[model samples]
Target: MEGAPPAKKMKTERQFDFSKCARRKVALMFAYLGWDYDGLVVQADSDNTIEEYIFHALEKTKLIESREACGWTRCGRTDKGVSAFRQVASLIVRSNLKEGPGVFWPEGTNAANWKETTQEIDFCQALNGVLPKEVRVLAWSVVPEDFSARFNCTQRVYKYFFARGQLNVDAMIAGSRLLIGEHDFRNFCRIDKNKARLETSYVRTIVNVTLEPSKWSCDTASGSSAYDMLELTVVGSSFLWHQIRCIVAVLLAIGSGRESPEVISQLLDINTHPRRPQYGMASETPLCLFDCSYDGVNLEWTWQPRALNATIVHLQKIWVDLQTKANMVRRMLGDLEELPGASGDSNGMTDYLYCGPPAKNYIPLLQRPTCDGLEDKREKRNAKQNGAPQTLLTESL
Candidate 1:
């Protein structure tokens, strides 16, 4: 055995030469179940991000040379545990067409006989083949090279789904109506000191907000109809980080009779409440980026029938698995409620939907401890950037 020659290693598949292919700018519409992901964006400390997986698929499929060289932009950045149905992103990538509008052919390529109606690469299929089942590339559209997914988006829609367990839906709806129109939302968002200055405007326009019954039905046999799902849809031009979650938290508080509908108006009055009250946001698991609208872009997304059907089938399977588990839990709850001393009340269920544990004693919103003002946060950030001592900065604050 020691004298035998070393066995030859099998040949690896040759990597595609992207330099020889034509390139074009494209917008991709994709969806993902984000519960298991770190977040939508790639981070330095973790590889479990939606964008990281997306770029990996692109590279594996030879669709893009590299993420750095690709002119990448996303319409929205969802937080950890959030999901998306119609999230969009744009980038320049290798194309199959040798000559066409927005296409860049390799040098010295003869394009005299190139047809204007030549077919392009099946981007959705290509990416989906390599991407995980939780993520799906729905469709792709060839766009102008100048198009930017983030900047060109005209509107964004978010949906938060929750159980209607003893919640006052009417009061919640009243509070949501107050959120319509432009308002300073500093009190309802987590300010990122690194990206925002003290003078940064938090004014954002909310076109509409609505509450409706979700399509997903509860198991009637398990007596779970009382916990029917409800959907809160928020439409806006843009939003600050954690704005939707914060708003939901407040609305849920109102629904639970802990705050009045007037609290919304009070928060919107920046002069009255400049600093945000220290309160937990709603859970991110129920939040979703529903849609991103680009009004005049004329993005005619192309979809392959086979790929579309495959995506549908995969999603159906996931729904069946989740729904079955939910039903089992509901049945257990129903059985527990049948106990002799059990009370059927579920008034406290909403408390569990909040990100942090509920306080033992409820404090009114205005009376609660408030976060530092934007100016103070900016000053502290600047001091830290200048390498000031932590103790000195704390004393200064």
Candidate 2:
């Protein structure tokens, strides 16, 4: 009996009867730390994305047969390393709710005893259990059969946070207002080759734009503005590839007095600047998809007791982890200050520009600095099209 290979255990996780499950249209609200992912969408080159984990959980839970069958549509395809607080996705999923004359009717009129018979699927509990700690399924809602997360979304909110170096906060605010209406933003975003193939327009409308101090800043007047975190909030119908980051880059330049606020106007004018200026975008580490809005959809989010407890524990652990590192750094700096001549301030000549400033020989942006634009891309493409041998295109991060 000992040599009989121990009577193999049945694999319950992978093998499931999906055909017997009832399907319903649902939308899931998610929050995730995207630093560990290759962005939200599943790509051919990588399987480590947030979407991959969601689908894996769905499969494991026997929620659906395949990703395609779910008719899944995401509200926004956030960039890599960009976090999200209110990401939403619509899909067809397996449900255990009962339908009848009045209860769970197409018209949404529920019977008195409908609540007693119908039961909601524990989507968050199931997915959170299987998903990595960086990602979490916040809640799920029963949506209409015709609901679409992408098209039905009324607006999207994006927030980018950064330290306000020597930049002008008021000037950045003034420049942000110039983006409030519809405009051809070719200069504010990189072209998406796939979308461009269909002759898509670069025109998009900005509903609102504002820059304010984040909670990280101390209220005291003596607090260092260079270390104070500022938040750029943008609300729009839709956005282009790297649009938010490009805009942030421009604002940073404006704040630094390198460019006037009118530069935004000049760049937006098609006749003035058809091609985008060459400039590095803001870092992706502090960018986030803050929220997505839907009109007329009353999403009732239900949290199970066990799942709620698990979420509390998970979040507390993250806080503690950060707190420990912060405390260690604080203590280390205090100890260093106690050393000889270590507590003294820097000399007036050794001023720190935070991010923009550098050592004595550092070139400023006001100087004639080179930047890549559409013309550069056009020339390369033309050369290749004209029978000139070209290597595969590669780019740095």
Candidate 3:
């Protein structure tokens, strides 16, 4: 202890003075591998959210003075273990330009020659420098002050990936086609009684739904396409909670011949089936928020070459790492299958995507137990909030 050298002091980095810089409302295009994050939203109970990391990076880089003052808005909120390729958010951030669209200069600044100014701050590079590698800011554009990332979004596209393990692609396609127009999707979503009113509309417009071969190829060393990847692409104006996962669950049932494609239409018929039948939603790991489109907003994304190159490199590293692990697992599986008297037929669908344990005697969807209808759920929630006697409501029922 006596011979130990004096402990080194941690250097304190100086904070940036945001008051000296101009501020502008900018829209950021970003992506995240959300497997490790709690979710995209910041929660009071957890600090491991994607948005938490993002706001931390923004503040650390002095992109904004504070999260509260930044007026941040996100395009969509992704659940835990879900990923996004082209998620967008708009926020007011510090800027270098003295005069430009959405730019707010500090009081008493010289209003002279703005065209001769230096280029704006490279937001992608700045944020990526401090943010986790899983999350990357791809590009940014100056937007009008009133522009909203959520409200102005014209369309949201989601993609769910799955293996072709004994699934009837044609049947799944037919079922998905039934979801491509406006309909009451109450039966296909988890209702949040705390937030939704009894009279809240369950209607949503789906622009398109298509199933296609995945761009990512599968390993074919065994000369079997059973494990070939496929993608279910859904484009819509908006979605309800757990809607995509529920839809995929029903499609999985139809693809496996457990239910007919007409089951979709039956679920959509709220007049006949007012309550949602109890069914497990599909796994969330393979779901992705593929893209968000803003038709009315004029957003010209500016990508810095260095930032773009860094992002590509980072993504390549992730791909190589995951692919290597996957290949190793596949090799192990093949070796196990070659053993003496090994049954080569395993339930691949259950192995890849979880939709609940297999029922020994599968019950039809219409014959299953159902959840409380909207009005009943609302009454229960209201009773709880109003501190009314639960027994009285039960007696009335």
| Cα deviation of 242, candidate 1, in Å | 0.4
Q: Write the per-residue lDDT of candidate 2 for residues 340-382, one digit (tens) a residue.
A: 9774332221132122343355344334333434444555566
Candidate 1 residue-wise lDDT, 161-230, digit = tens:
9888888899999999999999999989987666444657889999999998897665367556567888
State TM-scores per candidate: 0.92, 0.79, 0.91
| Candidate 1 lDDT for residue 294 | 98
TM-score winner, 2 or 3 = 3
For candidate 3, the clash count comes to 0
Q: Write the per-residue lDDT of candidate 3 for residues 1-397, one digit (tens) a residue.
A: 8999999999999876555677899999999999888989999999999999999999888888889978899999898889999999999998878877888875644435233567888899999999999999999998998999999999999999888878889999999999988999999998875654466789999999999889877758787667678999999989988899899989988988899999999999999998888888889999999999999879999989999999999999999999899789888988887899987764765546765566678788999878887766777777788998653322210
TM-score of 3: 0.91
Model 3's C-alpha root-mean-square deviation from the true structure amounts to: 3.3
Error of 3 at 324 (Å): 0.7
User: What lDDT score belongs to each candidate, Candidate 1 first?
Assistant: 0.88, 0.74, 0.87
Highest TM-score against the true fold, candidate: 1
